[model samples]
Target: MPTKDHYAAITTTLLVWGLSGALFGALFVGLYQVSWSLGLPGWQTLLVATMIAAMTTSAFYSAMPVALVGTMAGVLASISYLIAFGLKAELITIAGVAGVAGVAAGSLYAWMVTRGSRPLAEILNGLIAGLLAGGLLVLAFALTGWQVNMFVLAAVAVACVGTLFQLSDGWLVDRVAHWLPAMLSAPVVAGVIAAVVGASIWFIGGTTTALLDDRMTAALEEILSSIPSGLLGGFVGGALSGLLLEFLGFRLEAGR
Candidate 1:
């Protein structure tokens, strides 16, 4: 059976992520809106939204580390948006400053979460996770000419995977971790996650966007395309992180 904590975390993630996404969409609806929203850049908005969600899931334990995960994910999402939409110089600067902050924050969080193990390994793992996922988001946007909305889907993917890892004191993650060689488990998990997110984005809004973004609206085609991107990106991310994690001894402790 799942613990109370698992139930709480899932609920928190569901609400926080969902609300944050909605808020972001509403807040950034127009050029004037973006300027009006306290003059903060879109990425900062994402960071704040993610931070709010992370606080809920990470509050009791791993709170700080979880914050790092959210911050990095948001910053990278912003960078991918820039690339996908054709870079605006302002956004590039935003990406750079946020990237540095993300690195510092990620390093601290990795050290906190991984104990005495090399913090760089977990930090790198998170970075690669962002990169692989971001690449897929960029590719999909470039090909289809969709807006930068896939980050919401990516957030769901990360949340589901992260929540799964926290279950039964990491029992679920450990079961999978042990079943596959540490070397291999990372990519499998990553691919599954990316595929799920890709498929999810397709089902959730790709269909609708088809009618919108200039009849560039081939729902079936785009959904089909996302599958491979998910798989390929997942494999790359999984392999790199898996190997590094194994090297860093980043095993989860299960139920007592």
Candidate 2:
């Protein structure tokens, strides 16, 4: 059903976002490395990066300052909890923090964007949704008993639930959400998109390498040295997956 323009928009958007996301991906990963080097907790770095992704992507897609602030608050709240209850941090604690933060971020975005008659209802809905999401994720984890870090799981739940809670009424939003639950439901779509973009980036890189094999290969190597291929690949991967949230109708335009 999409026209040529739609496909064109998709291409352009992917290029720009993919590049930008590469920058973020590389930078965040670098920060994590730095954190590890500095002996900071891995959970700290992971949670912070995850929160940043959630906040930045929400702002980029939703065009809502409120969303950014709310997400920031959510991030801060999680950190504050960790700081306050360092040794006593439990799974419920992480889940509760994620749920509360998600609700705050999602409700604020929904409220500011919708201008609907039921802002409170939406926020409350988000609250319930966040709590339910956190609880469900926790229960799922308990059943399967993932060996991964709890903070990462918390972050995933918050990100997914936050976006879900921010759903506003729109034809496109509803339509897309049926297939993609605000970026969470359709992992395969997001993964496939990211993989394709990454492949494209690598292909371009390979072509450039071939073009300069004889003359400017040194220059190419220098450039690659400066711009890490891994970072670039990360950027493409993030861009591919992050923007799908928008396409999935997570970011609702005003008045449908």
Candidate 3:
């Protein structure tokens, strides 16, 4: 049976990540709005905001320097892609490039965070996690076509990627006995957790009114409209991630 300490840790993780998600979600909307106002493409703005929010959320969760570097790397890659391809790039092309960039960002973050220990396994975990995270971000953007709330979409994606990124570090990367194949298995587990949490956030955010448009044409007044969605989605995702991690045999380190 789980102890009170476990429950407390779960509660803590949920609160911390939820607040973090809300904070980052707001930042995402602001950044996206600014970029959109400057006439950037919807996909381009989404990439910029998503990468920044995801990296910042990662840093908040892990309290690591690699998150800073990861943020820079991801942002630069997004900007570079925009400069090279312009607005004419197809969604499939964007997805492929984003996947590649995510792999690089994840590998770099894993290498730096682990300091070259079990490099292959850690890098593998990063690659898989990053790819999925990147692809899902685009999916979230696409969901906007179906009228999904942008704030919820961003919160769900960022919260999912951020939690999984650090969870793998603690559960698999930090352990020596976890082999290459076993390490590679982390993404499958993380993906399932993310899917559940993402869906919950979607439901929570979807039922409400979307204040701001996620696209470049949204008016300035709508920028702050998604704050509520961000907060709620972040809280739900963080709480569920904590509960799931605890059940999976990982200790939730408070304030870390």
Candidate 4:
């Protein structure tokens, strides 16, 4: 029952976000190279870029109107990174990989939102999934003997929560009467959650490192820090693009 306008909005939003994500992904690759060349921790640079992408995408997605908003946001944000930082063939490969992942993640999230499920169920599912993934990553680091950085982990955690919100907002908005207020408060909640998760990961990683001389911990930490940021960025970017499309009188639910 969606209208023509809605379809248009969704299409435009997806187009914009996809392009942006590819650009960002390239940029991130470049940044990673630069950081590595400069003797900076590759993970730290990646973490910063991811944070930027997440915040930008989240802000845009929350206020925007469109289906597949989260996916678009991810794509666009990734594109931005590519444009700014990408270089060699390997970097290009990474960008492509990220793009595919973004598409898959975005599609799944969009489907969930459109289905209008219970907010609590969605949130719980997201959180559980994230935690399981994160924990596994931590364990992987322990096996490899790596070091963990708290700041990067914190940023990643925040980004993850933000991404979850972006994908589940429709259900959340309808379930909670004070949805707008909650949306407005999301960043703060995300920040706190990120801090807690980050701290917990850091503590666990550190303890494991002390008990076991695994240097792979650092690599795990880096991965954890970056993934959330990338996801967050995509969410925010898609949201913004969707909003812009909506403002132009395009709806993603027209003719229903």
lDDT of each: 0.35, 0.43, 0.52, 0.41
- What TM-score does structure 1 among the candidates reach? 0.27
Highest lDDT, which number? 3
Clashes of each: 2, 1, 0, 67
Can you give the TM-score per candidate against the true fold?
Answer: 0.27, 0.34, 0.50, 0.30
Clashing pairs for predicted structure model 3, backbone only: none
Q: Write the per-residue lDDT of candidate 3 for residues 115-219, one digit (tens) a residue.
A: 333433444444444446656766765876544576566556655665566667756656743444443232222222222222223222332224324552244
In candidate 4, what are the lDDT values of residues 38-157, reduced to their tens digit?
A: 467544554544443333333333322221343353445444544554432233343344444444544454455443323223334334434443444345555886664433333334
Better of 2 and 3 by lDDT: 3
Write one digit per residue (lDDT tens) for candidate 2, span 1-256.
8679766666666565555455444433433443444466645554444434333333334333433444454455555665776545543454356445555555555445543323223323433444454456556656886764322433344444444545432333344434433322122222222222222233233433544446455543443443354355545554545466567854322232
Name the lDDT value of residue 185 in candidate 1.
25
Task: Report how far residue 226 has shifted in candidate 3, in Å.
Answer: 3.2
Local distance difference test, candidate 1: 0.35
Candidate 4 error regions (>4 Å): 57-165, 168-256
Q: C-alpha displacement of 135 in model 1, angstroms?
A: 0.6
Instruction: Note the residue pairs that clash in candidate 1.
Output: 187-238, 210-217
